[model samples]
Target: MAKRGEALRAAHLRYAPRKTGSGALHCFVLDCSASMLARGQLALAKGLLIALFDRARGERVEVALICFGGARAELRFGPAVPRWWNERWIEPVGAGGGTPLEAGLARASQLLERAARRDPGRARHLWLFSDGRTTQFPARPAHADHVTVVDCEASALRLGRCRALAQAWDGACIDADAMLA
Candidate 1:
């Protein structure tokens, strides 16, 4: 059940006047870790990323990329279109060391927050790619309007941590195979 304020907001959005070309922002937080290399998950994710970039190129969406592994995270591209994105660029991304999923989410949150400040009405979506090997849990960032956690875990014994993370954020959760399908 929706609260009074939530219902009112939903009503407003439901009946609101349409605006042409209200662009959206897509923040992709990628996991580049040794675990992802199992079952060629990292390779599959890279392929998906390229496809996603191609789709974004056809639309009025701004895309950002954040890859986390080892002990830290870095924003390779952000707050703008990736004019140089291609297979060649995606090939060099290394996968090793710790998962650092928390650091990745934190960095993605920062980017989302900044984008929200610039355009509060613009749609902000977060796409997290991980196998959920980390032990850290972080609160969902408020700036992200929507979140989807794509679990890359391929082990026979699955922990379902990605689904747990999605539930915690009230977001969507899908495995890589499901997503690809």
Candidate 2:
């Protein structure tokens, strides 16, 4: 090659490292039911969600929330940066209704699927807080990269359905207290 010296001249110094923690989505499915209201579980769950949203914000990870109760589920936030989350936004989250776990999961799955279509390489995580009060079962979403289930059920007779759901999803299962810890 006659450009041996040209190769050396063409080399310019540029320093960059692989980017990480960007384009990540954290989908939280919070169970806001009468059972959750019994022992302030709903409050605890909301507190945890706020903390999680803050952490995700610090990491530049997008956060989304789905609250299920009253036989309905709704997305409270989004699969975008949680820049708009604050105490006012967190205050209006009401409780006292039937636990619609399946509906929450279904909505989350839809969000994950849509996100996958938009950004295939983006990381997606699902976090569910439930008392395992429902008999309905929802399948693990194929679009989610990971899932974590927290059983908010605090009683003498535990159904262990939250753990079962976690097992089915091939994800980690922990208690509400454990989650805080």
Candidate 3:
């Protein structure tokens, strides 16, 4: 089987650019809840995020990051320099606190809003990496052009939720574990 990177590269190559006149902006909302520590998924997610960032850079797409774990989410990276997507600054993410999907989604939406305000012509893409066990969903933002949910859990229940969430948002869903295969 192809590696995750290869798979992602292939998928990306197959992606058709949105017809919007604005440039593309890719935002990654990563779940850092303690459960991610169980199967080294956090590390893998971080690595994949960096790889995506590299691809975004190569394509000159703007990139940003938002991390959620505890009661709240944080904008760990930026709506600024796309070059700041370096993995070195990504702290070791561990699981423990409850998943704050609503918070994370809200923050991501806000970031995208800011980006749009700065450049309304830019296309917006959101990538969410999570275990899909969250209790809440933030109201979907109206501006997101596309969303991709990456499920990191190995259990059926979690995967189901991931798929459900993707469907609810009319977005693509990916099983991170399977992608790694």
Model number with the top TM-score: 1
TM per prediction: 0.86, 0.84, 0.80
The best candidate in terms of lDDT: 1
Q: How does model 3 fare in lDDT?
A: 0.78
Residue-wise C-alpha lDDT for candidate 2, range 1-181, written one tens digit per residue: 4355465443454557655535689899999878888777788888888888989888888889999898899998887787756678988989877878878888999999998877777889999998888888888988889999978888788899999999999999988888777
- Which candidate, 1 or 3, has the higher TM-score? 1
Candidate 1 residue-wise lDDT, 1-181, digit = tens: 3455464654454454555427899999999988998888899889888988888878858999999998889998766765657888989998999988878888998899888877778999999988887788889988889999988888999999999999999999988888787
State, as a TM-score between 0 and 1, how close model 3 is to the true structure: 0.80
The TM-score-based order of candidates, best leading, equals 1, 2, 3
User: In order, what lDDT does every prediction score?
Assistant: 0.86, 0.85, 0.78
Q: Model 1's lDDT to the true fold? A: 0.86
In candidate 2, position 168 carries an lDDT of 91
